[model samples]
Target: MRARLMEATVELLVERGFAGTTTTLVSERAGVSRGAQLHHFPTKNALVVAAVEHLTERRGEELSRAVDALPAGGNRTRAVVAMLGDHFASPVFAAALELWVAARTDEALLAAVAPLEQRVGREAHRMTAAALGADESRPGVRELVQATLDLVRGLGLASTISDDSTRRRRILGEWADVLDREMARA
Candidate 1:
């Protein structure tokens, strides 16, 4: 039931912005009783926050599982970039984006999401570094990893308006080459 509610919440968050998503809609979508929904999540804030957290965790786990398939050598950088790019362009990213936008104006949401986003950002950085086999101890390498994440996130945001897949792939490919060179130099 909890999983169903969370899944419903994410779906609604993507289809309807945070302003449109509500406990009533989520309960109806989840096909769960209102009483049960309240028992699980006492407020709208609690439900959405929990749903986002659940989806984020699922995304992280998916990345970890996919990391094994990342190429082992020369093409590894491109593969990692491509994989992360796909991840940022996923529905989970859209749901998180809704939360981020909503949090900007809603103080209560900001309070709930700020720390969650911090943790999510840290995990993304750590995962990207690991996936790239990047040595953050080396100078400039940390910044490069951060840049990669920022670039992909920007690309994802752009994708929200239009299909940027062709341009995105080109940019990521070029970035992978540069990233390889920089990592080698570092």
Candidate 2:
């Protein structure tokens, strides 16, 4: 029942933005009684948080697998591009986009998301820093990855909302350039 509701919420988040995704819609789409949904999540935010948590865990696992599968000297650029490709093409990211907008006005949503964002950001920075042979303790490594992540995410948003495949390819190309430069330096 919990998974059903969460799945429904994710679908609705894609269909309707966060402002429009109500518990009522989730319950209806899940084909479950409202009472069942309320039993698991008293508030819509609880469900959103749960869905986001699930996504974060799944994304982490996917990233770990990708990193493990990469060749030595590592082709970090291609790995990053592939990860971004999969991420941007996913409907789940549409749900995340909705949650991001909602978090601006909802304190509870922000609270739930902040820690997950920090964890993911740290992991991303660690990957970039390790690839570049930079110390993880340094701010420069983290800042660079942060900028890269933002660029990729922005391109993802553009793809999702505007169907901009060219923009997506451009973003991937840009990452490749950065990676080439960094790997050269390394």
Candidate 3:
């Protein structure tokens, strides 16, 4: 039931934005009573935050599986960039975008969302680092890994507003090339 409610919340958030995702809508969409939803999540903030956390964790698992499936000692840079592009274009990121926009104006929501966002960001960083076979002990490797994430995230944000698939592909390819060259120099 909890999972159902969270899933419904994510769907509604992606479809309707934060303003449209009320407790009533979520309960109805989840096919559960308001009472049941309230029993599990006492407030709208709690419910939305839980939904974001749930989706983030699920996406992280999916990313991990995708990473694990990549062939070893090949062009990991291109593979990682492609995988991240798919992830950024996903509904999970759309839902997260809604939350981020809402949180900017809503203090209560920001308070609830900040820690979860931090955790998600950290997990993404760690995953990117691992995918790149980054040696964290190196001075600039970690920074470069973080920059890759930032670049991918920026590309994802642009994609949310426009059909930038061609541009995104080009950027990813170019960035992968740059990263390859930089890593060689390092």
Estimate, for each residue in 42-112, the C-alpha lDDT of model 1 and write its tens digit.
99988999999999999888887798776599798998898888888888889999999998999998999
How far residue 104's Cα lies from its native spot in candidate 3, in Å, is: 1.2
* Candidate 3 accuracy as lDDT: 0.88
* Native-to-model Cα distance after best TM-score fit, residue 69 in candidate 3, in Å: 1.0
Better of 1 and 2 by TM-score: 1
The candidate that wins on lDDT is: 1
Q: Whose lDDT is higher: candidate 1's or candidate 3's?
A: 1
**Predictions ranked by TM-score, top down?**
1, 3, 2
* Model 2, global lDDT: 0.72
Best prediction by TM-score = 1
Give the runs in model 2 whose Cα sits over 4 Å from its true position: 73-76, 127-139
Model 3 C-alpha lDDT per residue in residues 39-150, reported as the tens digit of each score: 9999988999999899889988989889988997667788888789878877888899899899999999999888888989899999888887777786777789888888
**Candidate order (lDDT):** 1, 3, 2
Model 1 scores a TM of 0.98
Quantify all predictions' global Cα lDDT against the true fold. Answer: 0.93, 0.72, 0.88
- Model 3 CA lDDT for position 95: 91
Over 4 Å off in model 1, which ranges? none
